[model samples]
Target: MRVRAESPGPSWADVGLAEPGHGWSGAVLAALLRRRGAAVLSHDTAAHLHGMPTPHAAAPSSLVHVTLPPGQRLRREGVAPHRRDLPAHHVGAVHGLRATTPERTWADLCTRGAPWTPEDLIAAGDHLLARPWSRRGRREPASTPEGLAAVVAALGGVPGIDAARRALAQVRVGSDSPLETRVRLDLIAAGLGEPILQFRLDAADPQCPEVDLYYADGAVALEYDGAHHLAREQQARDARRDRWLLARGVAPLRVTAEDHREACRRLVEVILGRRAAGHRIDPRPESTSQSGHDAPPAES
Candidate 1:
């Protein structure tokens, strides 16, 4: 039910008292209503409302995405009108405003006409499938990986069907961040063998230490270090874990947001060399760094 609002404005009190963060979404919803009473917010606008990754300029002042009822046509400045019949299940209300469900929003983004790149589309898909972590613990996912596949199947002839299919094929479960998705994609593009995701150090303990990407047979673990991983506390913990992993004959590698692509290339070479040599590769270069931390997070 979240809607975008511009600035402080009148506030979205009607939609449960708009907090400062709701201002942009409040304004977005209000504008959609003013343009076409029955228009349903959709595409990137819906993606933003659903708390999904979107482009830099997806705020209210940008083009507002709305899908009108079939055969209801009208054009106005600053509004993008989508002509389609949204089935009941594909449409839903959030924070008080009508927007496409997460599945449907992703479908719209994947369609041919949408501007999203394949990497971003896959990233969004990963976000949709990865289960949420709540105070009580991990919660049920908003949609399943199978459900997303079905969505792409149902939209076979849609505008971006081909791109959607490609993106869907790239989506993976347990991807916790866009950076992780990017690294996976980069590795795949480099023709490296697929790395097992979120591999645990102890299968018996659900809360056991895990690596971002792991090669089980080779005992090679790769981690994507974001800025928070550089904190002293996190570094200390990582140092202990790295030492433990080393003691157990596992090789640990770290890639940062700034240098993951190149690092992944080097990793592919290492993996290939290890596969040829028929043994685990030793951790190198990066291991010499301070406290075994990875790269810093990108500045906002």
Candidate 2:
């Protein structure tokens, strides 16, 4: 691909399509690497390459983020350059192009400053720690909670390390999606005590269903229903699970992307015994069951 005017020639060629598809980013990174061998794709670009969720607001699709050594700099039209000393362990390869490791990319994002909030950082951390399933079997997590903590600890003097540390403290291992992380954070912020993540009703039974967020004291189970719940088959399965939970005296509350906040508010009232007389807080009228499937991993 002929990426730059001043470059010697094409660094890579495509034998298939005239227009590059998903590999366009790789081609751009390759060309940039040709110009400066030390530069590596980092920040949002690395996050995307590592198959982690990249917040759209924090990473505009138009710009490719790159990191150079302490004194190195590259001013390119479509590239955003960051200067930092990346250790050997922090760098990795994605599709043959150099890029920061998933953990490093996440830490860099936390320290990137404004537009990257604590909630965003927490969500990213949850994603990194989540062990998603695949056709082959359960896949290993990108990083453990300890791995993220070590990264934060090593980044002592970095600009946003404090925010990263705070987010790290809140990151849990079982949240399946960013929405679940967000709802958990929101509920905690609202002064509701932290709910146990991926709570299983029967701890000894491997076949027992797990709730996304559960309050053992009140027997309240909060399940965040994402777009996948719209499927007819999933709906039927959810209905069965809800029936089973209700039969067991568990209050199975469901929250969709749209009504989560309201659900949380109603839950607080019910938990605190503040609901008005004759008022009742019910699960989302649709399906009130946990999603048995894990959140699909991001595309690599």
Candidate 3:
């Protein structure tokens, strides 16, 4: 029943009810498992199913990943099989296809041989815990920190367990993008202390802006301006936001892709300067707005 696929597209083979591709999707992987009826999707495959933040190195896989009960022999072609004991709760449906739970999938991704770095694993965890504005209009977190903690606690003597624990400690919910995660990590690595994620001033005031990274002690806020911040409309809006922050005596630092190399350095200077000046450095919005885009675009 091997044949080329057109709808889900090339590099795919149709094996009766299942269409497995080099980069087989979760639904396709689930279909393959349903045909086998004894295996559940796991590892990176399951991570994709759960919509976790994939690592930068991730590419389409040539084989579908599935886990079977211990002693179950699977001789299916195009399927990568592992013999493991999966709890019932850990096995569930994602996108109508049977796959490991988000927590289980995240844990598996942290294991040895999984193609993910510590940061990638942490970002995935953050994604799981984020309440993003999706098509569903404000989607709830797929998993919680407490749930992830329990999973890690219960899984003792597991392979890659140390890495999993390390990643868990770095995971923080409310990080809206990978850039935000990197900035947070970079600040800590640079001895700036941990910047709060999505920190807001005056919670009662809707006019008060929430920042990507907030240094409450120094009243300094840093924003990671990705591609979206480059638009003229967005630039104008950011200018207004900067003015608003300046009026409140908050030092707003906007980091664009260009500033990656010097961002931490510049940030340290600004924070120290503001601290030395005793937060009286600037109270006028007109004096603080930067020229050009919110964040300089990456070099061509």
The numbered model that scores best in lDDT is 2
> Can you write out model 1's per-residue Cα lDDT over 1-300, one digit (the tens) per residue?
234333533444554432332235465566556667667888877776677765422332266678988889867666678988887778888766788889888888888343577888888887887666677976776776667776667666877678777777777776767787788777767776566666665655444456777665467777888887989998987887787678777778887765564746777776667666665533333332211122112212
C-alpha RMSD values across all candidates: 8.6, 7.8, 8.8
Candidate 2's C-alpha lDDT? 0.71
Between candidates 1 and 2, the one scoring higher on lDDT is: 2
In order of TM-score, best first, we have 2, 3, 1
Model 3: number of backbone collisions: 1
TM-scores of the models, in the given order? 0.77, 0.80, 0.79
Candidates sorted on lDDT, descending: 2, 3, 1
Candidate 1 lDDT trough over 10 residues, lowest sum? 290-299
Q: List the residue pairs that clash in candidate 2.
A: 1-12
Q: What is the TM-score (0 to 1) of candidate 1?
A: 0.77
Model 3: per-residue lDDT, tens digit, 1-300?
A: 232365453222332123323555534554576677878888766765566666756654566678899999777777778788888888888666788899888887788454688878877877787777666665777887777877777677787888878888888776777667766677777777766666666556677666777775577878889888889997887898788888888888997655556656777777777667776322123322221112212212
Per residue, candidate 2 scores C-alpha lDDT tens digits across 1-300 of: 366456533332432212222234455568778889899888877776666665624543456788998888798777789999999998988767799888889889999866677887888888888777687965888887667777777777788887777777777777888888888877787776677777667655555566788765566777889888899997887887787678776778887766554646776666555223332333332222232222223212
* Model 1 stretches with alpha carbons more than 4 Å out: 1-24, 55-61, 112-114, 134-136, 205-207, 261-263, 280-300
Residue 153, candidate 3: how far off, in angstroms? 1.4
How does candidate 3 score on lDDT? 0.69
